[model samples]
Target: MSVPTPRSPAAAPAPTSAAHRTLWRWHFYAGLFVMPFLIVLAITGTIYCFQPQIEPLLYPGLLRVTPQGEPLSPQTLLERARAAAPAGAVATTYTMRNDPRASAEFIFRLPSGNSESLYLDPYSGAVLGSLSVEDRFMKQVRLLHRALLVGKPGELLMELAGCWTLVMIATGLAMWWPRLRESGVRAFAMRPASGRRGRWKEIHLMLGASLAIGALAFVLSGLPWTAFWGKQFKAITTAANLGRPGDAGAGHTHAPVREGNHAAHGDHRRHGGTMESLPLSEVPWATGLTAVPVGTSASAGHAPIGLDRVVAIAGSRGAGAGCQVALPGTPDAVYSVSCFPSDPKAERTLHIDPHSGNIVRDIRYDDYGPVAKAVSYGTSLHMGRYFGLANQIACAAISLGLMALAITGFVMWIKRKPANALGAPSRPSSPPPMRAWIAGLAVLGAIFPLMGVTMLLVWLIDRLVDRAAGVPSRPVRQ
Candidate 1:
């Protein structure tokens, strides 16, 4: 029996093509660089998806009230809120009809050279008390998520992470693409097999593929808001005739009118009374002016409508649920009544002159231009509000998927051995195929300006580390 024992089969040698090795290296290194950020994004994105539901619960008293009596006027609420605060503090009141509750908030400059927020209830006009940004859970989470508790550097890191995520998706797909004829496309998809490695691979592939499109959409839409991409996008948009035009009167070539000096003009207009003019800045907060106020157009003579009246008008105009009324700042200014109807697609913005209560302007989702509509839709998608429950579910699933991808990727990296050889030292492989190397470099350079720069830095660091570690380098031959 001892004599009959057969020799164990040797393990198959790993593939060693320069292209394959380079692809794996980039994928591995990029995964290492981006894992921490991906985790932060996943956690934050998951929490943010439920903000609409969570915010109401967290501030229930400020958001809702019993429908026992009529609500207070916006002006009265604002005054009450200010009385609750310091002497000079000004409060902004938000009167919400759908929830039957009102809220007032004031931003104050503290003695410590920082801004603080004080929340108040408009229904009872009681100060809920001041809240520090640090103490605010959502604010802290948002800051950490968007910027890693650091400022611009943190934001840049996040943008880089997002860009790397796209890279990971692309490289991952490329690596997973089966070259062999026998392998099914489903194999490249998700294949749940028995072992730990098999399970991890399945998760990595499945989650990566499922959320790739979503992640790409999120990244592309957000790129226009990034520093470099924003400038580039603005330039491109302007070149493509998509830029916002300057003010209508800009660059008008009208001849300049030589009006008399201030004193002369004042004397000339004194007799007309109707020709009197007031400073634009004083119009909103002005206290005294006996005669019919100067610059009183046809729309300015009627009585001003309060927030309550605005809400009533909006309801009468068939606004859907969750209507909000914003009071006019000046007599001639228009009250903005905005509503998000039961129909998730319906969003209406109405501007009504508070004086005459006449509708000055109306803009619905249907009225938006192509770019405006796209922007609105993109915002809705980003906030997970475009399709309500379905969107929420999709976002949640995407978050979970992202988390899974990160975990599995980390595990895969851990399973791989350090770059070394068995028994004897192995020679360095030749440079990668010229075409493949150029293509990868070009693609990466096009997508991330930082990549080429980072690669050069990495090369320098690698050289230093190799020298410091006393690892032998390939000899140069002349």
Candidate 2:
């Protein structure tokens, strides 16, 4: 007797709900606004992820150097780079070479409030080239990622887009949840039987679901770097003592150090708990940490010792290889060396007193508090540093996948559009379940201030338009 194989069962039909209709309506609008900005972010972000492999190719003159003899003195490198600058230019900070064959960068400021960088041969102190802040391509890409190439105003717009993207994801998942349950294993099943539009829908949905985890990772990783709300998020995490750099569990003595320069010690009351005003997400994990003193107070002590002594201190502390010492700008500024970008766990941040070259603060990844540890690791993963090229490729793939989804979504919208009408989901019957909806999204609004403002604007306009037409909204047919 031949045994018969069991056949798979068909999926049940998904039931519709009032909440789903309301969510779908909002999700459509959110997607309409967010899709374009998301495209820009994905493109720029993909480019940035491959920057490690690309920068050398783009600006070899400013990045690479011939390794000859030992590098020149740190002081000499600074002087030569500044001297090569235009008259009245002043050098602020210079980066020590992490790679022996890499060019040194001396950051300078001009009278017009613009910043420039001078690249020099660390061995001979010869100027390689100078690049103005705005003219650099990578710098512009960075601005594009944070803002829409529009500076502060652009930043607000981008933040709004990011928040709306989150909304879109939330609503998309809501619509997908019931469908998944009803469709069973076939929830992930794709069929191209209905021609182009149907194929696009299945492809878009599946790709989006596949990319969900990575997409969320990128979004959350970026939040801590946002200008307004992101800064606040950092401050909150730090204030809660959750971001301190040190292993609290191991009972390490984390001596509190002075944070930033104050007019006097009394000024500490005003800025005591605040993180230092370091560039946003510029340094790997330097914000909200205590700043070490220069081994002498500004009023009573001698000038800080030269950079050579600090380099020696860093070398003694096992930060010699693949490390860079950032020059101190202010008289009382401490010298800091960053090492071990390859592995977040092996990372080290050593701050030295420029006055006596004393090691003031030495922090390692294991030394971070819980939140700090998460943020640190998340940042590395987000930047594609954790897994090298593979990480970059994965991020790039996610970006490309998002682009595909956006294109397919727009195409579907076009194919379904009524001649002159907006291609939105059918409006809800009666008033929306907005009371609960607002309460649920209140947290999102708080975290993203601009999103909160947008919600208010949307609610007002929605009400005004509904009342003027004086008609109950009808649900759309699938």
Candidate 3:
């Protein structure tokens, strides 16, 4: 489990520099574990980035519309979606789509525990199509990105992949480091090809070196979504009042913090309230924070104002065409108007009084604290939403570059590996370096829980294999 600290080449140990060989070994082993996942992630992430472009192409009949007239009212669309829903299922929030040709999308939680997404033509109110959210193509891709589609278990594996990717990147950088001092920073420059292996090696090094910073950005940005690490991060932000405006879990405080979804924010908003549970909707940050203000009268007998009226109210206040009006599922709940525009600066969240149709709470992007603003900006950039086509193109290019790097690295391994054994680097000539490496890994494992577990397992297996055979598992490369 020991790893070597990086060093320059000229003053380094001669033929078998343990630091160089050890780091190369780490780079090799980590790549063996991480290459397949990176390929899948890059491919899926590229697909996801172009979702605005690809979905219409894939499901044109269901997604696109004629835009012949003013589309049906929000209430009518919801009713149509409900009628179209499978028996014993209930429709929840309706996603306000940006495209005029696009159908109104409704989310339905089925009795079978799977969620179904219903798409309806806004003009005709006809059922366009229904897809199980979990089984849907993009959902499956997203699951593959987060986890290997195995739910919680898959999440751990994906997290492990992510952690080791860090290891891969670090060791890969170490391996590339000597090139900088020796060849005058030529790792970024592809040399003229000498042989097939040499050709792949140059290209691989150049690609890795060129995209290293960007790849690092991608990995760091994605860390906010890992189950354990993400939660811990969110907890810190919430506690510090650093991210997500008005997102305090202890209900409204002088400090506001926002979590990713309206549902979680709403649950936190109701931390100390006594009214019936509120329906989960994609709400803006404020509505989740704004409890029925001090004077919200109990107008129990007056049945809630219909969805159309609430939509009109939000429209008057500039809830853009892309904003959704979520009707309260509970008697006490208010209308939640939420919109997440391509520009993170345009995010808006509102809570509407159901009885009187007033905007009780309105939170805009400008209200976000410093940390929240940075996070939102970073998240938007990561999603390829910030610069329109330029953003999409850049994200796609990085993804393709990552896949290329993984492929070339794998090909290099195949070319070099001997027939009789796994072609890992030889053991370092010294053993003392390992204790420090193990300590560092322990810290990494603590931060990335699954990585810690995996490292322990791998360490134990390596130890047992070494003991049983009276030697190291792989051949000494010296």
Q: Highest TM-score: give the candidate number.
A: 2
lDDT of all predictions: 0.54, 0.69, 0.70
What digit string (tens of lDDT, one per residue) describes model 2 on residues 124-187? 8888898887767888898898898888998878877878878877777767777688887677
In model 1, what is the error at residue 349, expressed in angstroms? 8.0
Tell me the tens digit of each residue's lDDT in model 1 across 1-478: 3677675685444445555555655666677788888888878877877877887788776444455465556567656655666655433224344455535544454445444555666556667766553546677777787788797888788877877776677776666665323476565456556654667777787777667788777666555555554455545544553432211112211112222121211111122111012111111101101111111234434566555566666666666445545433343334555554434246555445555554444445554334434544565676577788788778777766777788888886555434562111122356556586567767776756765666567556755765576654232110
Model 1 backbone overlap count: 0
As a whole number from 0 to 100, the lDDT of residue 266 in candidate 3 is: 33
Q: Which residue pairs in candidate 2 have backbone atoms (N, alpha carbon, C) closer than 3 angstroms, thus clashing?
A: 246-367, 247-367, 304-355, 305-354, 305-355
Ranking the candidates on lDDT from highest down gives 3, 2, 1
Tell me the spans in candidate 3 whose CA falls farther than 4 Å from its real position: 1-14, 83-87, 193-196, 246-301, 316-318, 367-369, 431-446, 456-460, 467-478
lDDT per residue, candidate 3, 1-478, as tens digits?
A: 8888877664533455667677777688778898998898898889888877887787888778889788898789888888879998876666665568788888887988777888898988999888777677777777787787788987777777889888788778877888887888655798787655889988899988888888887887777667777767666675676655543334453423232223322333443221112333333322333343221234534455667787777666567766765556555566666776677777777666666555555667777666667666676777788899899889888888989999999898888877976766665656437566657767888887777787678667766765676655233332
Q: TM-scores of all models?
A: 0.68, 0.82, 0.81
